[model samples]
Target: MLFALGFYTLQALHYYSPYFSIFAVIAYGLGISVSADFVCERLKSTRASFMGRNLLTAIGAVAAIVVMVFTIKDTPPTASNANLAGLAQYMRTSTDVPGDFYDYAKKPSYSVMCSWADACKLQYLSQRAMVSSANQEIGIKGIIASERFYQATSEDEALAMLRSLDVKYVVAGGRLTVWHGDISKIGISGANPDKTVRVLKGDELPANKVGQLMAARMVWSSARLASSGVTSPLHHFRLLYISYYDSEKPPLLLYEIVKGARVVVKAKPNSPVAISTNISFNTRRFTAWHDSGTTNEHGVFSTIVPSSSSLVFQLNR
Candidate 1:
């Protein structure tokens, strides 16, 4: 009774155990001991009391089976440890990092994004200062700041949060149960980003946390979006590595924030031009794209950015 009725937290979401789960061994044993004699004696009779016990136990057993069947994925820390292992190794290795990264112990680099219960597992394996963690090593305010960075729907807000925290690297994955929504899927929330509108501010219409971080820069999902001309491709951040993308391996991705490449374009005088690019990335895949500007009286347009690709320019008609 205590085991089945007591609350159990899975990936930080609290729910009552419904039936005889493996975790309820003690309860099962106790129940069996008490009911075994009752079962034998009741087999000789057809009273309501005996029937009720059998029916209730049958119902509970069924409920437990349903819950267990729906959750084939493993729980926290252990959930995707294999998937996250390679990315964690990359974080710890100095040779694999960009030119800006000195060392985890030596430089304030690599942001371990937070909020999910399983998140700390990655941070623990990375073995560095996470932006925040369930351990609360960075405290409540730090955790809130991390949450905002992940949850913010606006590019400015997300960048603000990153710059504010001096976060250079961002990581994604090891979480399967998304209780919330984020544009980049970097943050966790109860909102589904697909159904919700992405806004530039928390106070904007459809005032709920939807993610835009994935769109702010290139991501594993960006290729499909860019190919379909449905997305504004990655700019401010560069992909470092990703393991088992779009698979059951439960991918782990890493990216470094950078100052993008600057490109100047010559266009009709005083006109706002549209710009796009197809960026080859991580020496593994390609990601899009860049910025735009209005030309001066001289018909010269120039913009500095983090990265770029093949450039195509069109005047805003």
Candidate 2:
């Protein structure tokens, strides 16, 4: 009675309470073993009893199998560790991540984006990003740097801030809890750039957290590059282009298009020079381009491509 009924009780209790799975499994093993021993001793001397023992054991095993099969079927093949490994493989190998799968360390450069007010993660990102090049380490940095980061508090204020910073990149993913509306105006600037810029837009309404960071990184990297003279034969002079933001980054859509463009680039010590390029969905190709026009000698090249290709620069120099 205890064997059958007790097992049922544990199963029912543990099904809804995942925390108890290990304990329940242990209890079931112990209880079943004890019950088997008691039954064997109770009928020790009878030949017929041996047959009964076999029957009972078979029944118990079958019952356990039923429970296990149901549980195993409901649980994924890669439940925890295995599931995460599969996800990591997909993130690294797949060109586009599937919706069902997610990278455990989503933002390699940031630990994990937190609530805007989470000061701890913000500080950690800024201070610890260079500690390691590993994804987990980058995540630590991302979380800390973005801890105090908020989707623009206001369109006017954001625009003003961008203007003040002479900001080259601005990510526009809005917070559902805070800036729960369209952010079209937040990235717009009245000042014309001397060089060229690109914007990428996504088809998915309401971009995900990954999209937000990808956009921010593209812009951030672009802002850091300086102009160069030698260009890749692959890229020359071109106009605005289009590409799919299919990575764990922003989603971009563009109507106008160009590819294989090149631009001048310079970077700080130990940084690679970049050449602005565009991923053209229309052509199904990523092309380099050169930034024309002129700079004020500080090498700040700025020109507008399109708002849809939010990130328009690439490294080449």
Per-model CA lDDT versus the true structure: 0.50, 0.33
Report the C-alpha lDDT of model 1 over 1-317, residue by residue, as the tens digit: 54434323321221123242455533444454456447656767557456546765675566545444443332322335555665665666632343233244465444555445446766655555566566533423423455455545555666677776667777654332223332323322333433442333534323132224432223455434544546544456666677653554335667667666656777779988656666554446665554555799988786544452335333333
What TM-score, over all chains together, does every model reach?
0.51, 0.24
Which stretches of candidate 2 lie above 4 Å from their native place?
A: 1-23, 29-57, 66-110, 114-148, 153-175, 178-317
Model 2 C-alpha lDDT per residue in residues 155-214, reported as the tens digit of each score:
243334333322222222212111122222122221023222222244222433332322
lDDT of 1: 0.50
TM-score of 1: 0.51
Best by TM-score: 1
Model 1: residues >4 Å from true position, as ranges? 1-81, 94-110, 136-143, 173-219, 222-229, 248-250, 270-283, 290-298, 308-317
